[model samples]
Target chain A: EAGVAQSPRYKIIEKRQSVAFWCNPISGHATLYWYQQILGQGPKLLIQFQNNGVVDDSQLPKDRFSAERLKGVDSTLKIQPAKLEDSAVYLCASGAGAHQETQYFGPGTRLLVL
Target chain B: SQQGEEDPQALSIQEGENATMNCSYKTSINNLQWYRQNSGRGLVHLILIRSNEREKHSGRLRVTLDTSKKSSSLLITASRAADTASYFCATGARGAGNMLTFGGGTRLMVKP
Candidate 1:
């Protein structure tokens, strides 16, 4: 009955540095997601994974941002050459299904890029 | 980009008063959900209303959805200081595999 868990509640990095965040979803949840929430804005979906396969990542910045859900349970999101604008909160959520299910979110990783 | 927009970006009211927040979307959706986010914390799901359903209630929360107008509203009865937080409305578009597009969110401050 544990909720989604994330690591490194906060991070600070310089521009062009690489940063990675980790997420472990709730047990038995098949759908996992990563979202970016900028200050004063709603969360923007960065990528989604159903099991070990990616369901969607249209908004992901392919040039520098990448994520993987290996083994289909825990996932990681990485951003290389981070930009100052990338300073925002990274949230991870897990759902029981891909449709009509409630998504449980983690505390999120707050990344501050200098 | 955000698909939904919330009205009155910020609202302040005394505790024990009703708090109402409205959201409008631009596309077809399967369901609409509301979430509350405390300061520096992740979002917590409040309620979900399907496109076919008009209204739903949980505890002191009431949600109304109007598909024809593509709008929804959330009402918190007898609000408390604990209710102070950012409220967001998210839409699950048809055929989008339940990916949600969230609105900018409404910052509500319930004073005690």
Candidate 2:
């Protein structure tokens, strides 16, 4: 059983630049999520999708952060005009259903904005 | 706003010792989960306890939930050096649809 996959494990970019992170969830998983984890803090959800449709994105920064889980298998989180505050690890996770069950996570992308 | 907060931001103990961490939440929850994250890695689910449940044990890990106080505890007995990592507690509420509110995390260091 393959776990969730994400890339570029590490990214370094300048402030105001655009950065994009990709995620490929586990096979047959139905739900996907994107979370931002600042240093020394827990992950904060940015967006959630259930099969190509957004389930929740209330915490997402609409001004510069956007995410899409097209085809219900892969997802991409984009942070445009990135600020230094955006320098955090972006994690992607997947679950079997829309319940509080086990969730598999990817390696995560560590973004460092200068 | 974060729903839970873990005590003892960091802890260190020799191998074969017990490691106990606490998590306190703010509101009612449908379930609570614990995850471990190694240095520079993603989180791995360790255990999950439902609202109706009080205690669950998985191998060397034991979890207890007290809804009355809205708090939970994770006990790792005879922990090994491999157990050195950051552990986080996450809470799930009704109608959340799988959303998890996590705590700041407790860093555990087990010396061999």
What interface RMSD does every candidate have? 1.5, 1.5
Give model 2's docking category: medium
lDDT of 1 by residue, A1-114 (tens): 899999999999999999999999999888899999999999999999988999999999999999999899999999998999999999999986546367889999999998
The models' CA-based lDDT, in order, is 0.94, 0.92
In candidate 1 chain A, where is summed lDDT lowest over 10 consecutive residues? A95-104
lDDT of 2 at B17: 99
Candidate 2 ranges beyond 4 A from true positions: A97-100
Residues B10-107 of candidate 2: C-alpha lDDT, one tens digit per residue: 99999999999999999888899999999999999999999999999999999999999999999999999999999999998677457888899999
Score every model by TM-score. Answer: 0.98, 0.97
Candidate DockQ values, in order, are: 0.73, 0.70
Clash pairs for candidate 2: none
